[model samples]
Target: MITIGELGEKIVATWLEPQNYQILHHRWHCRWGEIDLIALDNHNSELVFMEVKTRKPQNWDQNGLEALNINKQKRIYTTAQIFLSKNPLWQNYNCRFDLILLTYIIRKNNSNQGLIKILNSNQIMYENYIFTIKNHLKNVL
Candidate 1:
């Protein structure tokens, strides 16, 4: 059986398809890190690099979209750069970053719902898991 995380992505990708987006890559991993999905909108002539997070509950660090941190973003960006370098076709394409946060839910009746939440954030370019992105406790590091 496919894992719950994979299942969640399948559902999300399906939803993104009819919207006129072409899926270019999935689970693209390298020595630096992994990028969950890469899609392109041929009509708009834009590229979308996506990161996905899967969880079982509302248990994030806080009530904010800080699940993916600075360190992670840096790795993702580097991976994207490398992908383009290898695939010159996307070299001049305008690109944007996206985040897909999916929550895997379970029910009492042995059934569950795959709740997929999509967030589009280009501000976060790195990962800071232990602290707030706008500010930091200097001594903590």
Candidate 2:
């Protein structure tokens, strides 16, 4: 079975494909770390580095911005530089770094809350489950 990270990357790629992005790489590992998704916007001639996170109610990474920490940002930036070096012709194009957060809310009493995005990480109280976006605290040890 694929892990959550792997599945998250796939979902993100699928989400971006119809949006007109050419996915160049996913889970590109480097000395720094893994870049979730690297895409090329043909129409805009820009490169986009995206970080994706998915979570169940109890495991949600809130705001999803936590997925891109300072170190992760640096790694993505450095990796983009390396990629740029290999294709100098595209160096002049714009570069963007973004993030996507996926989370689900659940309740035993009510099953219709699945479409709502949980706003608070620690304060929500559901009948059976609560969704919370958490800060990214992955230690690169």
Candidate 3:
């Protein structure tokens, strides 16, 4: 079974696909850390390194924002540098760090009457959870 975090990453990738973003890598790792998603903007010739966070509404950490502390950012930065060193083609492209935040909302309504009304463009209703894209912070790091 796919973990919640992984599922969130997949959802983010799917969302980006329609916007002309080509996914270069997923879960790229090194000694420092792992990057959840790496994508290239076909329109602007930019490379994006994304960190995806998935969480429930009632939890702490500002829905995973607080979890990305200074130390974690540094590790991700170092890992990005390592990735650049290995991938020479993408090295020349403009690079940026982005954060994708997703929230998992439990379905409270049994009837389908309000389901269509509740969902917006950035939300998806899965089995028993509604995954919503809470925020997309570009050039975060």
Task: TM-score each candidate.
Answer: 0.68, 0.64, 0.86
RMSD of 3: 3.8
Q: Where in model 1 is the C-alpha error above 4 Å? A: 62-64, 108-141
Model 3 residue runs over 4 Å out of place are 108-119
Could you give me the TM-score of model 1 versus the true structure?
0.68
lDDT (Cα, tens digit) per residue for candidate 3, span 1-141: 889898778777877887899998999998789999999988888999999999998678777888889998999999999999999998888999999888987777546542333356688665566888888898889
Q: How many residue pairs clash (N, CA or C atoms closer than 3 angstroms) in each of the candidate models, in the order given?
A: 7, 4, 0
Which lDDT tens digits does candidate 2 get at residues 43-89? 78777777777676444345455556677778777876776776787
User: Cα deviation of 69 in candidate 2 (Å)?
Assistant: 2.3
lDDT at position 112, candidate 1: 21
Clashing pairs in 2: 61-133, 61-134, 62-133, 62-134
Measured on C-alpha atoms, candidate 2 has an lDDT of 0.62
